[model samples]
Target: MDIGSEYLKIVIKRFKEAKVTAEKAIEQLTESELFWAPNEESNSVAIIVKHMSGNMVSRWTDFLITDGEKPFRNRDDEFMGDIQTKEQMMELWEIGWNTFLNGLKSIEEEQLLKTITIRNEPHSVMQAIERQMYHYSYHIGQIIYVAKFLKSSDWKTLTIPRKK
Candidate 1:
């Protein structure tokens, strides 16, 4: 495979890995725990999921032709703790990943150098992909941290145990 193809595959694999890691952490939490926030300023897991989903849909839908920040996206509303159930949260999570993964899969090797706009800011396709990769990874870390904090003694290590 060419370098572009290899790069795409790696990006997909990394994203899938991040998604699974977050899901594993989420599976350990109760529905109420998913909405728990340490402070008024902090976001709950549900809110984070909602925001990610919104971002994915806005950024990935018609990714090449349209701006990454869609006109219809209400980024501010995503932060509201409105996800009523774990099921709802999971549904949003799946939608976001599906949009992102499908969008990534659709890219051709030649498109990697093409410029795209996010909020009217120009970025090469590679740069845009890396941006989302970092963004999602950051949020997934937050989810894992919050889950660990909530689970405390009951938390199962997502990675190898500290001593093992």
Candidate 2:
């Protein structure tokens, strides 16, 4: 199996789909609903959005040169859930995703073979993309879970219908 640029594009496609899913899940929520969490240890939908945005920004921006963890990323604050409006969350989410996609779009095929330092160890672009795919998928699952938890009885499926 020869993996190449199309593989990267596939990852991007998944991210796009994941983004849409996250958005739809949040669309089901109200401002008060975003604050809903079943337990003291669980995260609210707002907190999930914050954490996902924070993670996206940290891992995607300066992807080629810097460690995945950015100095500007506030990992702790992401769990605090102080943001009151969905608009604010969406803006941050869009910014983070745009930055990530822009960075990914900028990479050339040759650069994909070059090693980039993620934490302290070196990872090829393929490895880095793989790492991020799992990471984002993990958080996206969290967002979906929180949304479902908040929606409870009235939850609706967000997946688009197949054309006959």
Candidate 3:
């Protein structure tokens, strides 16, 4: 059985689907909406994007050679929602995802069993990818929920339309 190729195919497909889902939510939001949080402690869409993008860059850059958590990443600052414009947010989003996907593409079949670290905890390469996929999807769900709330009546359907 070709476990490695099969795993890569599934991971890539899931990642692509996740990106499309997030983009659908993003399409309904304005710049201000991206930064809107429910309250002082909650995260905004912009903040979620920032955090995920930061994670992507850190985890994927030289993925096999380094810890998934990069030393330069300021995990706290990502929640600050410092991005002032949708353009900047999207650009950063693309930058991080591009880095992640490119890194994923670089992985070989043999690399899946190799050990990696996140915050000094050991994980197989596949385990690390699965971890990020779940983490990013969790944040993307938050982004979609917030965008849907912000759009209110104008919210276009990202999934199946409501029952007639």
Highest-scoring model, TM-score: 1
Give each model a TM-score.
0.98, 0.88, 0.95
**Clash list (residue pairs), candidate 1:** none
**Which pairs clash (backbone N, Cα, C closer than 3 Å) in model 3?**
none
Global lDDT of each candidate? 0.96, 0.82, 0.90
**Cα lDDT of model 3 by residue, 1-164, tens digit:** 79898899889988989999999999888877888887999998888889999999999998888888899999998888679899999998999899999988888989898998888899999998999889988998998899889989999988888994
lDDT of 3 at 24: 92
Question: Which has the better lDDT: candidate 1, or candidate 2?
Answer: 1
RMSD of 3: 1.2
- Candidates sorted by TM-score, best first: 1, 3, 2
Instruction: List clash counts for every candidate, in order.
Output: 0, 0, 0
For candidate 1, write residues 1-164 as lDDT tens digits: 69999999999999999999999999999999999999999999999999999999999999999999999999999998888999999999999999999999999989999999999999999999999999999999999999999999999999999989
> Lowest-lDDT window of 10 residues in candidate 2?
155-164
Q: Which candidate number maximizes lDDT?
A: 1
Ranking of candidates on lDDT, top first: 1, 3, 2
Instruction: Give candidate 1's whole-model lDDT.
Output: 0.96
